[model samples]
Target: MLVVGGITRLTQSGLSIVEWAPLMGVVPPVGEAQWQEAFDAYKRYPEYQQLRPTMTLAEYRFIYYWEYAHRLLARAIGVVFLVPFLAFLARGYLRGPLLRRLLLLFGLGALQGLMGWLMVASGLVDRPSVAHERLAAHLLLAFTIFAVCLWTAADLWPTPAPDEGARRRLRRLHAGLVTFGALLVLQVTYGAFVAGLDAGRAFNTWPLMAGGWWPPAAWRLDPPLRNLLDNIATVQWIHRTVPLLLLLVAALLVAGAWRPAARAGGPHRAWSVALLAGVLVQATLGILTLVTFVPLWLAALHQAVALLLFGVWLAWLHVATRARLAV
Candidate 1:
């Protein structure tokens, strides 16, 4: 859904379907008349008027399908989750904290769906694009949902038996990882800002923007802080800088986790290595995407890798924080 949502935003397909019909929208325009009607309705919006005034019915459908598939997938995920959930609840397989966890997930899923429509609605009024902040919200909420699921599953899994190594304090590594995860979330939010504003297109050069790092951001918005959100150069710079910081922090964590993970008594060694590797891969893809002017495939891959990196971080956290969890 994230990747498709990225594509939907990239192709400017988000506003293709003006209306938010949960059940009735399940079936898309089938016949010619239906297609024309859908297109006509889309024509009423600013995206069509300001961006693609001369778009054909066929062209409209192309963009329409991306958003449709994104929404369809969201619905499918909800149904997939709900059916098993209900069955489990009825069978008494889900209860207590587990039930509460699932219930919370369902509520978040529903809220995410609402956020999606709210994002779409942002672009329909006078502007041809969604608000960058809202786009970031939707993306971050999706990430949060995935993270919650991971954390919940970790809670359900049996904790490992503590060994003599558990005596060794891991407070530093845990703290470092927590910091990295927070930075990752901030980076992702700025990434959405970058995509929303097409910030990557400018500042084609990395390490330096338009020439030097001093400017960081080119234009200063009304309020000083607004530039962080509204300024393209600042957004790209932050996105660029965060990864370097993450890489540095990741390197430190890798170093810290190395011996512990290696020795039998240490934390699981694989997670730290996997996380570092994910960061490297994601960083490489990000550089490539920036240098190449954010090609569709590369950008899409970058988006996928970002999520992958986040997932890895989540998994590592589950392991790193297990001692605390056990308590």
Candidate 2:
């Protein structure tokens, strides 16, 4: 879904759908009349008027199908989740906290859909693009759903037993991981901000921006704090800087988790290492995406890697928590 979203955004197809019809939207335009109706409706939006005024019916369908498929996939995910969920509930498959967890996940999924619509609506008004903040929210919420699913899945597996002392260490390790996860979420959110502002296109040079290590205009946005989130240079700088911080934290996390005392009793040593590797891969992809001018393929890969990294982090947290609780 996110890959398609990246494509939609890159192709400038997101605003092609002028309305949010979750139920009826399941079936796209089936005939020329319907297609024309859809296109005519889209023509009412500012994007078509200002940005793609010359778009023909075929051109409109080109963009429309991407957004349509994106929406359809979202709806399918909901159904995919709901039917099994109800069946599992009826069969007592989801019991105790697991049921609550699934419900919470479902709610988040629902919110994600709403956020997508909110994002799409952003560009329907005066602007030809979605509000960067809303886009970030949409992207973050999608990851949140993915993280919740991973955490839930991790719960279904057995955890290694840890002695009391190791449990204490694991607790600390879990705390660190949780903190690291929070930071990752913030980093990704800011990354969305970068994508939203198209900040990646601003600094074509790696290890530096526009020939300087620190671009002069990075902090030029009024209200220094706003610059951190809104300014393209500042956003890109922060996006570039966060990976280094994450790497440091990841190294610390792995080192602490592998301490003789902690290592004696945690889940297999692989989870932490896998997480560190994911971080490295995602960071590398992000840099490549930036230096390469945010090409569609790299941008899509970057987004995919971000999701992968989030999953790894969630897995790490799950394993750590499970290890801490194991007798």
- The best candidate in terms of lDDT: 1
Question: Residues 1-327, candidate 2, lDDT per residue (tens digit)?
Answer: 888887888778898888888888888889899999999999898888887889899999899889988988888888999999999888888888999999999899889888998999888889878999999899888887877777788778776556666576677778788788878988988988987888888878888777887878777777889897788888888888888888988888888867886663444367768878988888888888877888888888888888878877887677667666774
Model 1's TM-score against the true structure: 0.95
Error of 2 at 280 (Å): 2.0
Write candidate 1's Cα lDDT for 74-118 as tens digits: 999999999999998889999888899899999999999999999
**For candidate 2, which ten residues in a row score worst on lDDT?**
261-270
Per TM-score, the best of the predicted structures is 1
Consecutive 10-residue window with the lowest summed lDDT within model 1: 260-269
RMSD of each: 1.8, 2.0
> lDDT of each prediction vs. the true structure?
0.87, 0.83
Compute the lDDT of residue 30 as modeled in candidate 2.
90
